[model samples]
Target: MEVLSLKVNGDTRCLAAAPQATLLEVLREELGLTGCKQGCDKGDCGACTVLLDGQPVLACLTLAALVQGREITTIEGLAPAHRRRCAESPCASKQDKLHPVQDAFDEAGALQCGFCQSGMILSATALLQRDDDPKRETIREALSGNLCRCTGYTQIIEAVERASDEHAGREHRPRAWEQPATEPAGEGES
Candidate 1:
Protein backbone atom coordinates (compact mmCIF):
# COMPACT_ATOMS: atom_id res chain seq x y z
CA MET A 1 0.00 0.00 0.00
CA GLU A 2 1.19 3.49 -0.77
CA VAL A 3 0.66 6.37 1.57
CA LEU A 4 -0.76 9.24 -0.45
CA SER A 5 -1.55 12.58 1.04
CA LEU A 6 -4.31 14.78 -0.38
CA LYS A 7 -6.27 17.84 0.62
CA VAL A 8 -9.88 16.72 0.78
CA ASN A 9 -12.71 19.04 1.66
CA GLY A 10 -10.19 21.59 2.92
CA ASP A 11 -8.55 19.09 5.30
CA THR A 12 -5.22 17.50 4.57
CA ARG A 13 -5.40 13.75 4.95
CA CYS A 14 -2.87 10.99 4.38
CA LEU A 15 -4.29 7.63 3.37
CA ALA A 16 -3.02 4.16 2.64
CA ALA A 17 -4.10 3.07 -0.80
CA ALA A 18 -3.11 0.65 -3.51
CA PRO A 19 -0.81 2.11 -6.09
CA GLN A 20 -3.26 1.39 -8.91
CA ALA A 21 -6.45 2.31 -7.10
CA THR A 22 -8.92 4.59 -8.85
CA LEU A 23 -9.82 7.79 -7.04
CA LEU A 24 -13.37 6.52 -6.74
CA GLU A 25 -12.41 3.33 -4.92
CA VAL A 26 -10.17 5.18 -2.53
CA LEU A 27 -12.86 7.78 -1.90
CA ARG A 28 -15.81 5.43 -1.37
CA GLU A 29 -14.18 2.38 0.21
CA GLU A 30 -11.01 3.60 1.83
CA LEU A 31 -11.79 7.10 3.00
CA GLY A 32 -15.53 6.54 3.47
CA LEU A 33 -16.59 9.67 1.60
CA THR A 34 -19.57 8.20 -0.22
CA GLY A 35 -20.98 11.40 -1.60
CA CYS A 36 -19.06 10.84 -4.82
CA LYS A 37 -21.22 8.03 -6.17
CA GLN A 38 -20.45 5.43 -8.80
CA GLY A 39 -22.52 5.65 -11.95
CA CYS A 40 -20.78 4.62 -15.17
CA ASP A 41 -17.32 4.44 -13.59
CA LYS A 42 -16.15 5.73 -16.92
CA GLY A 43 -15.51 9.30 -17.98
CA ASP A 44 -18.81 9.38 -19.87
CA CYS A 45 -21.27 9.70 -16.98
CA GLY A 46 -19.87 12.74 -15.24
CA ALA A 47 -21.67 11.43 -12.14
CA CYS A 48 -18.49 11.16 -10.11
CA THR A 49 -17.48 14.75 -10.61
CA VAL A 50 -15.32 16.54 -8.06
CA LEU A 51 -12.89 19.41 -8.07
CA LEU A 52 -9.23 19.09 -8.79
CA ASP A 53 -7.45 22.31 -7.99
CA GLY A 54 -10.83 24.04 -7.85
CA GLN A 55 -12.00 22.64 -11.20
CA PRO A 56 -14.54 19.91 -11.82
CA VAL A 57 -13.12 16.51 -12.75
CA LEU A 58 -14.33 12.96 -13.12
CA ALA A 59 -13.18 10.99 -10.07
CA CYS A 60 -13.49 7.49 -11.55
CA LEU A 61 -10.87 8.11 -14.19
CA THR A 62 -8.40 9.87 -11.89
CA LEU A 63 -5.58 7.94 -10.25
CA ALA A 64 -5.49 7.94 -6.48
CA ALA A 65 -1.74 8.27 -6.07
CA LEU A 66 -1.41 11.01 -8.62
CA VAL A 67 -3.28 13.54 -6.48
CA GLN A 68 -0.62 13.72 -3.78
CA GLY A 69 0.50 17.29 -3.16
CA ARG A 70 -2.68 18.51 -4.85
CA GLU A 71 -6.19 19.37 -3.74
CA ILE A 72 -9.11 16.99 -4.37
CA THR A 73 -12.65 18.17 -3.73
CA THR A 74 -15.52 15.68 -3.64
CA ILE A 75 -19.29 15.99 -3.49
CA GLU A 76 -19.17 15.97 0.27
CA GLY A 77 -16.96 19.01 0.04
CA LEU A 78 -19.51 20.95 -2.01
CA ALA A 79 -22.65 20.50 0.06
CA PRO A 80 -24.66 23.52 1.17
CA ALA A 81 -24.37 22.46 4.79
CA HIS A 82 -20.66 23.26 4.80
CA ARG A 83 -21.22 26.83 3.60
CA ARG A 84 -22.76 27.65 6.94
CA ARG A 85 -21.40 24.65 8.79
CA CYS A 86 -18.81 26.63 10.68
CA ALA A 87 -20.20 30.05 9.95
CA GLU A 88 -20.97 30.54 13.60
CA SER A 89 -17.87 28.76 14.84
CA PRO A 90 -15.28 31.02 16.36
CA CYS A 91 -12.67 29.78 13.91
CA ALA A 92 -14.70 30.13 10.76
CA SER A 93 -12.76 31.19 7.71
CA LYS A 94 -14.11 33.50 5.04
CA GLN A 95 -14.18 30.68 2.54
CA ASP A 96 -16.81 28.95 4.64
CA LYS A 97 -19.35 30.60 2.40
CA LEU A 98 -20.85 28.41 -0.34
CA HIS A 99 -20.03 29.17 -3.94
CA PRO A 100 -22.69 31.30 -5.60
CA VAL A 101 -23.64 28.40 -7.89
CA GLN A 102 -24.91 26.47 -4.88
CA ASP A 103 -27.15 29.30 -3.85
CA ALA A 104 -28.55 29.53 -7.38
CA PHE A 105 -29.30 25.82 -7.51
CA ASP A 106 -31.37 26.20 -4.37
CA GLU A 107 -33.18 29.32 -5.50
CA ALA A 108 -34.15 27.77 -8.83
CA GLY A 109 -35.52 24.50 -7.41
CA ALA A 110 -33.13 22.74 -9.77
CA LEU A 111 -32.89 19.37 -8.05
CA GLN A 112 -35.27 16.44 -8.25
CA CYS A 113 -33.90 13.14 -6.93
CA GLY A 114 -30.66 15.04 -6.34
CA PHE A 115 -28.60 12.32 -7.98
CA CYS A 116 -26.79 14.54 -10.46
CA GLN A 117 -26.88 17.63 -8.28
CA SER A 118 -23.27 17.73 -7.12
CA GLY A 119 -21.71 17.29 -10.53
CA MET A 120 -24.15 19.76 -12.00
CA ILE A 121 -23.29 22.31 -9.36
CA LEU A 122 -19.54 21.94 -9.78
CA SER A 123 -19.82 22.14 -13.53
CA ALA A 124 -21.82 25.32 -13.15
CA THR A 125 -19.17 26.70 -10.83
CA ALA A 126 -16.57 26.09 -13.49
CA LEU A 127 -18.80 27.64 -16.10
CA LEU A 128 -19.58 30.71 -14.02
CA GLN A 129 -15.92 31.28 -13.29
CA ARG A 130 -15.34 31.99 -16.96
CA ASP A 131 -18.41 34.16 -17.40
CA ASP A 132 -20.04 36.60 -15.03
CA ASP A 133 -23.56 35.86 -16.25
CA PRO A 134 -24.06 33.27 -18.94
CA LYS A 135 -27.03 33.25 -21.28
CA ARG A 136 -29.40 30.25 -21.20
CA GLU A 137 -27.77 28.89 -24.31
CA THR A 138 -24.41 29.38 -22.68
CA ILE A 139 -25.55 27.66 -19.52
CA ARG A 140 -26.91 24.85 -21.64
CA GLU A 141 -23.56 24.50 -23.32
CA ALA A 142 -21.72 24.45 -20.00
CA LEU A 143 -23.95 21.76 -18.51
CA SER A 144 -23.89 19.55 -21.58
CA GLY A 145 -21.48 17.10 -19.98
CA ASN A 146 -23.44 16.22 -16.86
CA LEU A 147 -26.44 13.88 -17.22
CA CYS A 148 -29.69 13.90 -15.29
CA ARG A 149 -31.46 10.52 -15.48
CA CYS A 150 -34.61 11.85 -13.87
CA THR A 151 -35.02 14.35 -16.72
CA GLY A 152 -35.00 16.87 -13.91
CA TYR A 153 -32.86 18.86 -16.29
CA THR A 154 -35.42 21.57 -16.93
CA GLN A 155 -35.37 22.58 -13.32
CA ILE A 156 -31.63 22.09 -13.16
CA ILE A 157 -31.13 24.42 -16.09
CA GLU A 158 -33.42 26.96 -14.51
CA ALA A 159 -31.44 26.75 -11.31
CA VAL A 160 -28.26 27.71 -13.09
CA GLU A 161 -30.02 30.74 -14.55
CA ARG A 162 -31.32 31.66 -11.11
CA ALA A 163 -27.81 31.23 -9.70
CA SER A 164 -26.50 33.65 -12.28
CA ASP A 165 -29.08 36.19 -11.19
CA GLU A 166 -28.40 35.66 -7.50
CA HIS A 167 -24.66 35.79 -8.01
CA ALA A 168 -24.98 39.08 -9.83
CA GLY A 169 -27.03 40.54 -6.99
CA ARG A 170 -24.71 39.16 -4.25
CA GLU A 171 -27.54 37.95 -2.02
CA HIS A 172 -27.08 34.27 -2.82
CA ARG A 173 -27.77 31.85 0.00
CA PRO A 174 -26.92 28.21 -0.13
CA ARG A 175 -30.17 26.27 0.06
CA ALA A 176 -29.12 24.90 3.40
CA TRP A 177 -29.21 27.17 6.42
CA GLU A 178 -30.71 29.95 4.28
CA GLN A 179 -32.42 31.07 7.45
CA PRO A 180 -29.78 30.07 9.94
CA ALA A 181 -31.35 27.74 12.43
CA THR A 182 -31.32 30.30 15.19
CA GLU A 183 -27.76 31.40 14.41
CA PRO A 184 -24.55 29.41 14.18
CA ALA A 185 -23.19 27.98 17.39
CA GLY A 186 -20.14 30.22 17.65
CA GLU A 187 -20.50 32.91 15.00
CA GLY A 188 -19.99 36.64 15.49
CA GLU A 189 -19.93 38.68 12.30
CA SER A 190 -16.53 40.00 11.37
Candidate 2:
Protein backbone atom coordinates (compact mmCIF):
# COMPACT_ATOMS: atom_id res chain seq x y z
CA MET A 1 0.00 0.00 0.00
CA GLU A 2 1.13 3.52 -0.79
CA VAL A 3 0.01 6.73 0.84
CA LEU A 4 -1.29 9.05 -1.85
CA SER A 5 -2.00 12.73 -1.39
CA LEU A 6 -4.32 14.31 -3.93
CA LYS A 7 -6.12 17.59 -4.25
CA VAL A 8 -9.67 16.86 -5.29
CA ASN A 9 -12.45 19.37 -5.73
CA GLY A 10 -10.30 22.03 -4.05
CA ASP A 11 -9.59 19.89 -0.99
CA THR A 12 -6.59 17.86 0.06
CA ARG A 13 -7.15 14.14 0.56
CA CYS A 14 -4.70 11.58 1.77
CA LEU A 15 -5.37 7.87 1.63
CA ALA A 16 -3.62 4.55 1.46
CA ALA A 17 -4.14 2.90 -1.86
CA ALA A 18 -2.80 -0.19 -3.50
CA PRO A 19 0.20 0.49 -5.68
CA GLN A 20 -1.54 -0.86 -8.74
CA ALA A 21 -4.88 0.75 -8.01
CA THR A 22 -6.22 2.90 -10.81
CA LEU A 23 -7.50 6.39 -10.06
CA LEU A 24 -10.98 5.12 -10.78
CA GLU A 25 -10.73 2.45 -8.11
CA VAL A 26 -9.34 4.84 -5.54
CA LEU A 27 -11.98 7.42 -6.34
CA ARG A 28 -14.90 5.03 -6.11
CA GLU A 29 -13.76 2.44 -3.57
CA GLU A 30 -11.49 4.49 -1.35
CA LEU A 31 -12.84 8.03 -1.55
CA GLY A 32 -16.48 7.06 -2.22
CA LEU A 33 -16.69 9.47 -5.17
CA THR A 34 -18.60 7.28 -7.56
CA GLY A 35 -19.41 9.82 -10.25
CA CYS A 36 -16.82 8.13 -12.45
CA LYS A 37 -18.27 4.85 -13.63
CA GLN A 38 -16.36 1.77 -14.73
CA GLY A 39 -17.07 0.59 -18.22
CA CYS A 40 -14.76 -1.20 -20.64
CA ASP A 41 -11.98 -0.81 -18.12
CA LYS A 42 -9.43 -0.71 -20.91
CA GLY A 43 -10.06 3.04 -21.38
CA ASP A 44 -11.92 2.72 -24.67
CA CYS A 45 -15.05 4.00 -23.00
CA GLY A 46 -14.90 7.41 -21.40
CA ALA A 47 -17.15 6.36 -18.51
CA CYS A 48 -14.33 6.99 -16.05
CA THR A 49 -13.08 10.31 -17.34
CA VAL A 50 -11.79 12.90 -14.88
CA LEU A 51 -9.70 16.04 -14.93
CA LEU A 52 -6.11 15.71 -13.81
CA ASP A 53 -4.35 19.05 -13.56
CA GLY A 54 -6.92 20.56 -15.91
CA GLN A 55 -6.46 17.85 -18.52
CA PRO A 56 -9.00 15.11 -19.11
CA VAL A 57 -7.66 11.63 -18.42
CA LEU A 58 -9.21 8.21 -18.31
CA ALA A 59 -9.45 7.44 -14.61
CA CYS A 60 -9.70 3.70 -15.12
CA LEU A 61 -6.30 3.69 -16.76
CA THR A 62 -4.62 6.35 -14.62
CA LEU A 63 -2.40 5.07 -11.81
CA ALA A 64 -3.51 6.46 -8.49
CA ALA A 65 0.05 6.89 -7.29
CA LEU A 66 1.15 8.65 -10.45
CA VAL A 67 -1.40 11.40 -9.92
CA GLN A 68 -0.70 12.12 -6.28
CA GLY A 69 0.52 15.68 -6.68
CA ARG A 70 -1.95 16.82 -9.29
CA GLU A 71 -5.36 18.39 -8.98
CA ILE A 72 -8.10 15.90 -9.77
CA THR A 73 -11.61 17.05 -10.58
CA THR A 74 -14.48 14.60 -10.80
CA ILE A 75 -18.09 15.09 -11.79
CA GLU A 76 -19.06 16.04 -8.27
CA GLY A 77 -16.39 18.71 -8.34
CA LEU A 78 -18.15 20.39 -11.24
CA ALA A 79 -21.13 21.40 -9.13
CA PRO A 80 -21.69 25.13 -8.62
CA ALA A 81 -20.35 26.76 -5.47
CA HIS A 82 -23.89 27.52 -4.32
CA ARG A 83 -24.86 23.88 -4.56
CA ARG A 84 -21.95 22.90 -2.37
CA ARG A 85 -22.95 25.54 0.14
CA CYS A 86 -26.54 24.33 0.13
CA ALA A 87 -25.37 20.78 0.65
CA GLU A 88 -23.42 21.89 3.70
CA SER A 89 -26.28 23.80 5.36
CA PRO A 90 -29.93 22.87 5.60
CA CYS A 91 -30.93 26.52 5.79
CA ALA A 92 -29.14 27.38 2.55
CA SER A 93 -31.43 27.82 -0.43
CA LYS A 94 -31.77 24.79 -2.69
CA GLN A 95 -32.45 26.86 -5.81
CA ASP A 96 -28.83 27.08 -6.84
CA LYS A 97 -28.26 27.19 -10.57
CA LEU A 98 -26.66 24.26 -12.31
CA HIS A 99 -23.26 24.53 -13.91
CA PRO A 100 -23.47 25.96 -17.41
CA VAL A 101 -22.66 22.65 -19.06
CA GLN A 102 -25.24 20.87 -16.90
CA ASP A 103 -27.81 23.52 -17.70
CA ALA A 104 -27.10 23.13 -21.41
CA PHE A 105 -27.43 19.37 -21.16
CA ASP A 106 -30.77 19.66 -19.44
CA GLU A 107 -32.10 22.19 -21.90
CA ALA A 108 -30.86 20.27 -24.92
CA GLY A 109 -32.09 16.91 -23.69
CA ALA A 110 -28.58 15.63 -24.22
CA LEU A 111 -28.66 12.58 -21.97
CA GLN A 112 -30.87 9.51 -22.09
CA CYS A 113 -29.61 6.60 -19.96
CA GLY A 114 -27.32 9.16 -18.27
CA PHE A 115 -24.28 6.93 -17.97
CA CYS A 116 -22.12 9.30 -20.02
CA GLN A 117 -23.41 12.54 -18.56
CA SER A 118 -20.64 13.06 -16.07
CA GLY A 119 -17.82 12.41 -18.47
CA MET A 120 -19.41 14.50 -21.18
CA ILE A 121 -20.04 17.40 -18.84
CA LEU A 122 -16.52 17.27 -17.41
CA SER A 123 -14.98 17.12 -20.88
CA ALA A 124 -17.06 19.99 -22.14
CA THR A 125 -16.34 22.05 -19.04
CA ALA A 126 -12.63 21.49 -19.42
CA LEU A 127 -12.77 22.52 -23.04
CA LEU A 128 -14.82 25.57 -22.26
CA GLN A 129 -12.55 26.55 -19.42
CA ARG A 130 -9.66 26.69 -21.82
CA ASP A 131 -11.57 28.17 -24.73
CA ASP A 132 -14.92 29.68 -23.91
CA ASP A 133 -15.81 30.19 -27.56
CA PRO A 134 -14.77 26.96 -29.20
CA LYS A 135 -16.13 26.09 -32.59
CA ARG A 136 -18.34 23.06 -33.10
CA GLU A 137 -15.49 21.12 -34.63
CA THR A 138 -13.30 21.86 -31.68
CA ILE A 139 -16.04 20.68 -29.36
CA ARG A 140 -16.41 17.49 -31.38
CA GLU A 141 -12.68 16.89 -31.04
CA ALA A 142 -12.80 17.57 -27.34
CA LEU A 143 -15.70 15.16 -26.78
CA SER A 144 -14.52 12.53 -29.20
CA GLY A 145 -13.29 10.29 -26.42
CA ASN A 146 -16.67 10.13 -24.70
CA LEU A 147 -19.19 7.72 -26.16
CA CYS A 148 -22.90 7.88 -25.40
CA ARG A 149 -24.89 4.83 -26.43
CA CYS A 150 -28.18 6.41 -25.43
CA THR A 151 -28.35 9.76 -27.18
CA GLY A 152 -25.75 9.46 -29.88
CA TYR A 153 -23.77 12.69 -30.51
CA THR A 154 -26.32 15.05 -31.92
CA GLN A 155 -27.85 16.64 -28.85
CA ILE A 156 -24.61 16.18 -27.00
CA ILE A 157 -22.82 18.42 -29.47
CA GLU A 158 -25.65 20.89 -29.28
CA ALA A 159 -25.37 20.95 -25.53
CA VAL A 160 -21.69 21.75 -25.72
CA GLU A 161 -22.37 24.53 -28.19
CA ARG A 162 -25.08 25.90 -25.95
CA ALA A 163 -22.74 25.74 -22.97
CA SER A 164 -20.08 27.58 -24.93
CA ASP A 165 -22.53 30.36 -25.64
CA GLU A 166 -23.61 30.51 -22.02
CA HIS A 167 -20.00 30.63 -20.88
CA ALA A 168 -19.26 33.38 -23.36
CA GLY A 169 -22.22 35.37 -22.17
CA ARG A 170 -21.10 35.06 -18.58
CA GLU A 171 -17.69 36.31 -19.55
CA HIS A 172 -19.34 39.61 -20.49
CA ARG A 173 -21.10 40.02 -17.13
CA PRO A 174 -20.01 39.58 -13.53
CA ARG A 175 -21.55 36.58 -11.81
CA ALA A 176 -23.54 37.07 -8.61
CA TRP A 177 -20.75 35.62 -6.53
CA GLU A 178 -18.20 37.93 -8.09
CA GLN A 179 -20.29 41.08 -7.80
CA PRO A 180 -20.31 43.42 -4.79
CA ALA A 181 -23.16 43.13 -2.33
CA THR A 182 -26.27 45.12 -3.13
CA GLU A 183 -28.70 46.72 -0.69
CA PRO A 184 -32.39 45.83 -0.50
CA ALA A 185 -34.29 46.69 -3.71
CA GLY A 186 -36.52 49.26 -1.94
CA GLU A 187 -33.55 51.17 -0.46
CA GLY A 188 -30.95 50.86 -3.25
CA GLU A 189 -32.21 53.71 -5.40
CA SER A 190 -32.45 56.23 -2.59
Candidate 3:
Protein backbone atom coordinates (compact mmCIF):
# COMPACT_ATOMS: atom_id res chain seq x y z
CA MET A 1 0.00 0.00 0.00
CA GLU A 2 1.21 3.44 -0.90
CA VAL A 3 0.47 6.39 1.35
CA LEU A 4 -0.57 9.38 -0.66
CA SER A 5 -1.03 12.86 0.76
CA LEU A 6 -3.22 15.34 -0.99
CA LYS A 7 -5.54 18.24 -0.32
CA VAL A 8 -9.23 17.47 -0.68
CA ASN A 9 -11.95 20.02 -0.23
CA GLY A 10 -9.56 22.36 1.59
CA ASP A 11 -8.48 19.67 4.01
CA THR A 12 -5.23 17.76 3.97
CA ARG A 13 -5.84 14.05 3.60
CA CYS A 14 -3.63 11.02 3.74
CA LEU A 15 -4.73 7.56 2.82
CA ALA A 16 -3.16 4.23 2.05
CA ALA A 17 -4.03 3.12 -1.43
CA ALA A 18 -2.67 0.79 -4.02
CA PRO A 19 -0.23 2.59 -6.25
CA GLN A 20 -2.32 1.80 -9.31
CA ALA A 21 -5.65 2.64 -7.73
CA THR A 22 -7.65 5.30 -9.48
CA LEU A 23 -8.55 8.59 -7.83
CA LEU A 24 -12.20 7.52 -8.08
CA GLU A 25 -11.45 4.48 -5.98
CA VAL A 26 -9.60 6.47 -3.38
CA LEU A 27 -12.27 9.14 -3.19
CA ARG A 28 -15.23 6.77 -2.98
CA GLU A 29 -13.69 3.95 -1.01
CA GLU A 30 -11.15 5.63 1.24
CA LEU A 31 -12.46 9.15 1.65
CA GLY A 32 -16.12 8.12 1.64
CA LEU A 33 -16.97 10.59 -1.09
CA THR A 34 -19.44 8.78 -3.32
CA GLY A 35 -20.48 11.76 -5.43
CA CYS A 36 -18.10 10.87 -8.24
CA LYS A 37 -19.74 7.85 -9.82
CA GLN A 38 -18.14 4.88 -11.49
CA GLY A 39 -19.72 4.61 -14.87
CA CYS A 40 -17.48 3.68 -17.80
CA ASP A 41 -14.28 3.36 -15.75
CA LYS A 42 -12.48 4.40 -18.92
CA GLY A 43 -12.92 8.17 -18.54
CA ASP A 44 -15.29 8.37 -21.51
CA CYS A 45 -18.57 8.75 -19.64
CA GLY A 46 -17.53 11.71 -17.48
CA ALA A 47 -19.63 10.54 -14.55
CA CYS A 48 -16.42 10.31 -12.58
CA THR A 49 -15.60 13.94 -13.05
CA VAL A 50 -13.95 16.01 -10.33
CA LEU A 51 -12.01 19.23 -10.15
CA LEU A 52 -8.31 18.64 -10.01
CA ASP A 53 -6.60 21.92 -9.27
CA GLY A 54 -9.85 23.71 -10.23
CA GLN A 55 -10.03 22.02 -13.64
CA PRO A 56 -12.34 19.21 -14.60
CA VAL A 57 -10.70 15.80 -14.66
CA LEU A 58 -11.92 12.23 -14.79
CA ALA A 59 -11.19 10.68 -11.42
CA CYS A 60 -11.61 7.20 -12.79
CA LEU A 61 -8.58 7.59 -15.02
CA THR A 62 -6.49 9.74 -12.67
CA LEU A 63 -4.06 7.68 -10.66
CA ALA A 64 -4.25 8.53 -6.98
CA ALA A 65 -0.50 8.53 -6.71
CA LEU A 66 -0.09 10.85 -9.64
CA VAL A 67 -2.22 13.54 -7.95
CA GLN A 68 -0.49 13.47 -4.57
CA GLY A 69 0.24 17.17 -4.43
CA ARG A 70 -2.75 18.43 -6.39
CA GLU A 71 -6.05 19.68 -5.06
CA ILE A 72 -9.02 17.41 -5.61
CA THR A 73 -12.56 18.60 -5.20
CA THR A 74 -15.49 16.23 -5.32
CA ILE A 75 -19.14 17.10 -5.74
CA GLU A 76 -19.49 17.18 -1.97
CA GLY A 77 -16.84 19.83 -1.86
CA LEU A 78 -18.80 22.00 -4.25
CA ALA A 79 -21.88 22.17 -2.00
CA PRO A 80 -20.55 22.79 1.49
CA ALA A 81 -22.94 24.06 4.13
CA HIS A 82 -21.92 26.21 7.01
CA ARG A 83 -22.43 24.76 10.47
CA ARG A 84 -24.89 27.46 11.45
CA ARG A 85 -28.61 26.82 11.28
CA CYS A 86 -30.75 28.46 8.60
CA ALA A 87 -32.83 30.22 11.25
CA GLU A 88 -29.76 31.96 12.60
CA SER A 89 -28.30 32.91 9.24
CA PRO A 90 -29.26 35.69 6.87
CA CYS A 91 -28.60 33.56 3.83
CA ALA A 92 -31.49 32.01 2.00
CA SER A 93 -32.84 28.66 3.07
CA LYS A 94 -30.16 26.00 3.05
CA GLN A 95 -31.17 24.76 -0.37
CA ASP A 96 -30.59 28.03 -2.16
CA LYS A 97 -27.18 28.37 -0.58
CA LEU A 98 -25.92 25.29 -2.35
CA HIS A 99 -23.48 25.90 -5.14
CA PRO A 100 -25.05 28.13 -7.77
CA VAL A 101 -24.81 25.38 -10.33
CA GLN A 102 -26.60 23.02 -7.99
CA ASP A 103 -29.23 25.61 -7.23
CA ALA A 104 -29.65 26.23 -10.94
CA PHE A 105 -29.99 22.52 -11.59
CA ASP A 106 -32.69 22.26 -8.97
CA GLU A 107 -34.48 25.38 -10.11
CA ALA A 108 -34.38 24.34 -13.75
CA GLY A 109 -35.56 20.80 -12.99
CA ALA A 110 -32.41 19.60 -14.65
CA LEU A 111 -31.97 16.45 -12.60
CA GLN A 112 -34.01 13.24 -12.76
CA CYS A 113 -32.20 10.02 -11.87
CA GLY A 114 -29.34 12.18 -10.53
CA PHE A 115 -26.63 9.80 -11.68
CA CYS A 116 -24.98 12.43 -13.81
CA GLN A 117 -25.92 15.49 -11.79
CA SER A 118 -22.68 15.62 -9.86
CA GLY A 119 -20.51 15.48 -12.93
CA MET A 120 -22.72 17.93 -14.78
CA ILE A 121 -22.68 20.36 -11.86
CA LEU A 122 -18.91 20.13 -11.50
CA SER A 123 -18.43 20.64 -15.22
CA ALA A 124 -20.71 23.66 -15.10
CA THR A 125 -18.82 25.02 -12.11
CA ALA A 126 -15.51 24.74 -13.90
CA LEU A 127 -16.88 26.35 -17.01
CA LEU A 128 -18.45 29.21 -15.08
CA GLN A 129 -15.24 29.80 -13.20
CA ARG A 130 -13.66 30.50 -16.56
CA ASP A 131 -16.57 32.33 -18.16
CA ASP A 132 -19.17 33.91 -15.93
CA ASP A 133 -21.44 34.57 -18.89
CA PRO A 134 -21.06 31.73 -21.33
CA LYS A 135 -23.32 31.42 -24.33
CA ARG A 136 -25.55 28.41 -24.79
CA GLU A 137 -23.08 26.84 -27.20
CA THR A 138 -20.31 27.22 -24.67
CA ILE A 139 -22.40 25.60 -21.97
CA ARG A 140 -23.16 22.74 -24.33
CA GLU A 141 -19.52 22.27 -25.18
CA ALA A 142 -18.49 22.36 -21.54
CA LEU A 143 -20.92 19.60 -20.61
CA SER A 144 -20.61 17.57 -23.79
CA GLY A 145 -18.65 14.86 -22.07
CA ASN A 146 -21.23 14.19 -19.39
CA LEU A 147 -24.13 12.01 -20.52
CA CYS A 148 -27.49 12.02 -18.80
CA ARG A 149 -29.82 9.26 -19.83
CA CYS A 150 -32.92 11.02 -18.56
CA THR A 151 -32.85 14.81 -18.98
CA GLY A 152 -31.92 14.81 -22.72
CA TYR A 153 -29.50 17.74 -22.19
CA THR A 154 -32.02 20.53 -22.66
CA GLN A 155 -32.58 21.03 -18.95
CA ILE A 156 -28.90 20.68 -18.27
CA ILE A 157 -28.07 23.45 -20.67
CA GLU A 158 -30.81 25.58 -19.21
CA ALA A 159 -29.46 24.96 -15.75
CA VAL A 160 -26.01 26.19 -16.72
CA GLU A 161 -27.48 29.28 -18.31
CA ARG A 162 -29.58 29.98 -15.28
CA ALA A 163 -26.54 29.62 -13.06
CA SER A 164 -24.67 32.02 -15.29
CA ASP A 165 -27.44 34.56 -15.01
CA GLU A 166 -27.50 34.18 -11.27
CA HIS A 167 -23.74 34.62 -11.13
CA ALA A 168 -24.00 37.83 -13.07
CA GLY A 169 -26.80 39.01 -10.87
CA ARG A 170 -24.86 38.23 -7.75
CA GLU A 171 -21.95 40.28 -8.98
CA HIS A 172 -24.27 43.25 -9.14
CA ARG A 173 -26.31 42.48 -6.05
CA PRO A 174 -25.14 43.48 -2.63
CA ARG A 175 -24.43 40.85 -0.01
CA ALA A 176 -27.15 39.72 2.37
CA TRP A 177 -25.76 42.01 5.04
CA GLU A 178 -25.46 44.96 2.68
CA GLN A 179 -29.10 45.79 2.07
CA PRO A 180 -29.67 49.46 1.25
CA ALA A 181 -29.93 51.51 4.39
CA THR A 182 -33.29 53.04 5.10
CA GLU A 183 -33.68 56.69 6.20
CA PRO A 184 -34.43 57.23 9.86
CA ALA A 185 -38.17 57.25 10.51
CA GLY A 186 -39.69 60.77 10.20
CA GLU A 187 -36.25 62.31 9.90
CA GLY A 188 -37.50 64.89 7.37
CA GLU A 189 -40.64 65.78 9.42
CA SER A 190 -38.70 68.05 11.83
Give the C-alpha miss distance for residue 43 in model 3, angstroms.
1.4
Task: List model 2 lDDT by residue over 1-190, tens digit each.
Answer: 9889988887889999989999999999989999998888998989899999888999999999998779899988888556877767756543354676887888789988999989999999899999987766788799999989784688888888788777777432211223446866666645
The per-residue C-alpha lDDT of model 1 at residue 185 equals 89
TM-score of candidate 1 to 2 decimals: 0.77
Weakest ten-residue segment in model 3 by summed lDDT: 171-180
Top candidate by lDDT: 3
Note the residue pairs that clash in candidate 1: 88-186, 88-187, 104-163
TM-score per prediction, in order, is 0.77, 0.82, 0.82
Candidate 1 lDDT tens digits, 68-126? 77878776776455566776688876556666667667767888888788889888887
User: Which has the better lDDT: candidate 1, or candidate 2?
Assistant: 2
**Candidate 1 or 3, higher lDDT?**
3
Q: Which stretches of candidate 3 lie over 4 Å from their true place?
A: 80-92, 95-97, 170-190
| Per-candidate local distance difference test | 0.78, 0.84, 0.84
Candidate 2 wrong stretches, greater than 4 Å: 80-82, 87-97, 170-190
